[model samples]
Target chain A: MGGSTVEPVVRESVGSAPGNLAIASLARTLRCVECGHETRLEVHQSCPACLGPLAVTYDLSTLRGSVPSDRLSGRPRSIGRFAELLPPLSLPWSARLDLETTPLRPAPRLAEWLGVETVWLKDDTVLPTGSFKDRPASVAVAFAAAQGHRAVGCASTGNLAAATARAAVRASLPCFVFVPAGLPDSKLDPVRQFGGQIVEVEGPYDVANRVANLAAEAAGIGVVNITLRPYYTEGSKTLALETFEALGWNPPDAIALPLGSGALLAATERAISQLREIGWIPSGPGPALLGSQPDGCAPIADAFDAGSDEIVPVEHPRTIAESLAIGDPGSGYEALRAIRASRGAADSPTSEEVIAAIRALARTEGIWVEPAAGTVIATLRRLREAGTVRRQDRVVAFLTGAGWKISHAVALSRVGSAPIHLDPVHPDLSQLHVGPRPEALGGAE
Target chain B: MTTLVLASVLRQSAPSLHQKEYDGFRGSLLEFLNTVSAEGGPSFRGRIFDGDRLRRYLNVFVDGTDVRYLSGLATPITPTSRVDLIPAVAGG
Candidate 1:
C-alpha cells in the first residue's frame, strides 16, 4: 500500500494556465466538507483523504468592499455576473450558451394566504431547459469544454437530463444520459431532441447513477454530477445570488426550496455565507434555509425530524413528484447540517398535499409549477401553521420546474362536460337551448 | 479478531469475500482492506481501495455511522466493532 502508485484519475488534456491564473489572484482551495482535508483543484469526485464531498473555498478578503452594488447591477443578468466567486472556467460568454436569469416575482396573494409580510417566488421555470438544473448544467458543460473533454454525461431523474443535453449540444460536445426505465415521454423527448444518447436503465435512479459512475470512471467521460461535481455544484449558488440581488442585496428572512439531492439548498446557503463574507450583504446570519421533500422520498427530512446526523436511505421511493424522488440523496448530510445550522426546518409533504399545493399556487399566483415546486409551497403552508414561519417574516419559495412538462401527472378532480358538436357549414341551431330572455332592467325592450 | 460484512454488490467482485473474520487485525481501516485484498484477490483490492484510500464511491461503516464522517481510512477497528462496506448509492 505504501509504494503502490495510483494513476491520476482525470487527465489534463488541456493547459491548466487559465484555471491557475483565475485562482492565483484569489485565495481559493478545495476542502472536504466532512473532514477539512485539502483536495487538489481538479475534476475529482470526492476528497482522497476522507472520501467525503469536496467544496470550493474562496478567500473573500479581496472581494470585500470592492464589489460595488452598482458594479454587479451593471453586469449582464446571468450567473456569469458572479464570476468572482465561482470556480474558474475558460469558456467565454460569447462561446457559451445563455442560461438566462429567472424572474423573482412578488406573490402578494401568496403572502396574504400565509399571512406573511411579503413572499417572493424565485421562479426557475423560465430557465433554458425549463428547470433550475440548467444553472448547474451551464457551468458544468463549460467546465468540461475548458478541460478539453470531448464528451459529457449524467444520470438524471428528468430535469437534469434535459438541461445537460441542451448544454452539451450548445457546447458541441457529445452527451450521454442514463435515466430509469418507465420515465415519461415529456422528460425523455427533450433529451433526444438535444441529441443526447439516452440509456434507459432497468432499475431506479440510484441504479442508473451507479451505472453512470462506472461509465464515467471506465471511459473517462465527464459526468457533471460525478467527476466534475466540485465545479458543477458551484453553479447553484447563483440561485441565492439572484435572489439577494433582486432584493437590493438584502437577504430574505426565510427561503423554502425543494430538496432532491439537497445540493441546491446547500449551495444556496454557501452563496449566502460567501456574500456576507465579501460584504455584498450585511454581516449577519443570512436567511433561514428551509428544505422541502416529497413524502415518498424524504430521507433528509426524516433525519432532520429524528435529530440525527445520519440519513437513512429509502429502499423504494414512490411519489408523483418524480423529479424529487431521490431515495438516497448524496448531499443529505450537508443539507441537514445547513438546515440545522440555520435553525431551519425540513418537511415532506404527501402526494395529495403536493398536488393540491400545485393547484393552490396556480389559483392564487397564476404560477403553474411541477410537483417538486409544489412541495415547497406545501411546506411553507405547514410552517406557517406550525408557527415556525412568522407572519412578519419575508419568505421566498423557489419554484424549480415548469408545470407544462408534468401536466399529465396533475389529474383534474372534475372533468368538464363533453363539448356539444356543431356542423361547420350547416350549424345545428336546435342543439342550443335558450331560456326565456331576462326582462329589461327599466321595462324597455 | 474483527468481523467484516461485505455488501451484496461487493459479493459480485469478490466471490469468496463475505462475512469473514480476521484474527490479529488490530489496524486502521486501510490496513484491514489491504489485508483482505491480499487474501481475496486483486479484483477486491481494485473495487475497495484506490491506492491506500478507500474508493470515494464506497462507504465504510463502523457500527452504524459512515467512517468518512468519523476518521476515514485512519479510523481504527476493534474486536467489538462491526465493519460494514456498503456501495455508495445516490439518485441523480
Candidate 2:
C-alpha cells in the first residue's frame, strides 16, 4: 500500500461557494447524499459528516431549455461539449485527453429480434481505452492535476487500469495502478503501455482496491475511484446526457446498463433526475433504468429480485464477465434506489446467455462488445419476455466495452461458424464454409 | 457495555483505539459518536460529524448492519449492542 514521490496538498476551503449561482448562473457545490451538507469545491474529500459519499450539484434552478448553453458551438465533439453543467475544470492543453462522443446508433435489427419497437445501442466501444471508463478517468486526472496533486492512480480489474493510466500519462503525472496479481498480460499490457507503474497486489480486486486507497491517501495521489470519485463519477453522468441529446432531448422508454460497482447506472439516474428537474426532459415518468449483471456476480440483481435493499456481497464471484465481477459493489444501494425509483428492475443473465447475446449483437447490429454489455443484452431479452419492458417500448442498451477485452473468453466458448482452415493449394467449396446465417447468431452456421 | 469499533482509514484518527466498552451510555448513535469523536481528536471529530449529521464517508453499523438501513443515528443501541464505525470504501 505505497508508492514513490508523495506530497501533501492542502485545500481548507469550506462548504458550498453559493450565491454565485443564485444570480441565475452556473454555480456548483458538493453535497452529501446521507446528510444534505454542502461543501465548496476541493480535492480529496467525502462528506465530512456521516462519512457518506459526496456528489456535485448544479444550481439549474433558473436555467431554461437545453443543457449546454450555446457555448459549445465551436468546441470539439467530446465530453467537454457539455461542460456547462459539469464542475469547472482546467485541463491544460498540453495535458489534455479529449473524450470523444460515442455513437447512439439505431439497432433496428436488434429491435426486430427482441420484438421491441425500437432499440438504440449506446456504443461506447470506440472510446479511448476501448471502454467507458475513459470518461471518468479524463475528469479525475484533470481534477487531480488542477488540485495540485503530485500523482494519480486507481485500483482496477482491467478497463479502469488502462483508462486511468492513459489519462494520467496525458496529464504528465506519475501514475500507479493497483491490480490483482495473476491477471493476463493482455490486460496489464494496455495499462503498462501508458507508462503507468503497475503494482500487482497479491490478492483479489477488493483487496487491491483497499491497498490502493490506503496507498493513494498516504501518497497524496488522487485515487480516481476513491478520493477523487466525486469528480470522477461526475464525468460518467454524461453517458445519459450524450444519449438524451442524441435522441433530440427525448428520454427513452427504458435504458439498460451493465451493473458492477453500479456507478454507471446510478450516474445515469442522476443525469436523468437533473435534466427532469430543469425541464429539459418532460417531467412525468422518465426512462426506466434496467441494471444488468452476470448471474455469478449479481448482488444488486439479487437484492432487487428479493425486494430487499440489502446487498449480500458475492464473496467469490465466478463469471466470464470479468469487468462485471464486482462482488461487493459500493454503489449497490444507489443503483437499487435508481431502479426502484424508476419502477425498473434488476436481473442477471447466465454466462451462456451472455455469450449468446454477444454473438447476437455482433451478427445483428454489427457491434461486438465485452461480456459486461452482453449481460445487458441478455437482460433486455428477459425483460422484454416478462413484459417488464413492453414490446412497444423504446429501449437503449449500453454496450460499454470492446469485445477484444474479453475475446479470450469468447474464444473458449463455442462461437460463430467454426474456423475453416482451408488448404490453399487445393481449396475447395466444401472446405469454404459460407452457409446460411443461423436463426440466432450463436448456433451452427 | 457496548463494543464500539472503528475501521479502515478512520482508525488512523486514534491509533491506540480498538474495541471500546461503553457502559451506561445514553442517547442516539450520533450522541455516542460525539463522545467517540472527542476521544479521537478535534481533526478526526470534524471529519466524522457536521453538527447533528454523520459525515457522508462513514457508515455506522449496529450489530453488523449499516445504521443507514436502520433508523440512522437514532437506531437505538443498548449496553450489549455492538457498533461498528466503518468508513465507506469504494469498489471499482
Candidate 1 C-alpha lDDT tens digits along A1-445? 0122212122222232222121121327788887698865677676654457788888766566654554454445667666667776654421364455779998877777767778999999988778998988887888788888979988899899999999898789999888999888888889999999998987778767767766776577798987788778888888888899889877788999988988888898888888777667887664898999999999999999999877877757898888988877878888899998888999998888787788778877888888999899989988998999999998989999988777567664213446789999999989887789955534111
- Which of the numbered candidates is closest to the native, going by highest DockQ? 2
The residue-by-residue lDDT of candidate 2 on A226-324, one tens digit each, is 878888888888888899988977889999999988888888998898877766678888599999999999999999999986777775678888888
DockQ of each: 0.17, 0.27
* RMSD after CA superposition, every candidate: 10.5, 9.6
Residue A399, candidate 1: alpha-carbon lDDT: 94
TM-score of chain A of each: 0.88, 0.89
Sliding window of 10 residues with minimal summed lDDT for model 2 chain B: B7-16
Which segments of model 1 are wrong by more than 4 Å?
Answer: A1-27, A93-95, A412-445, B1-57, B60-91
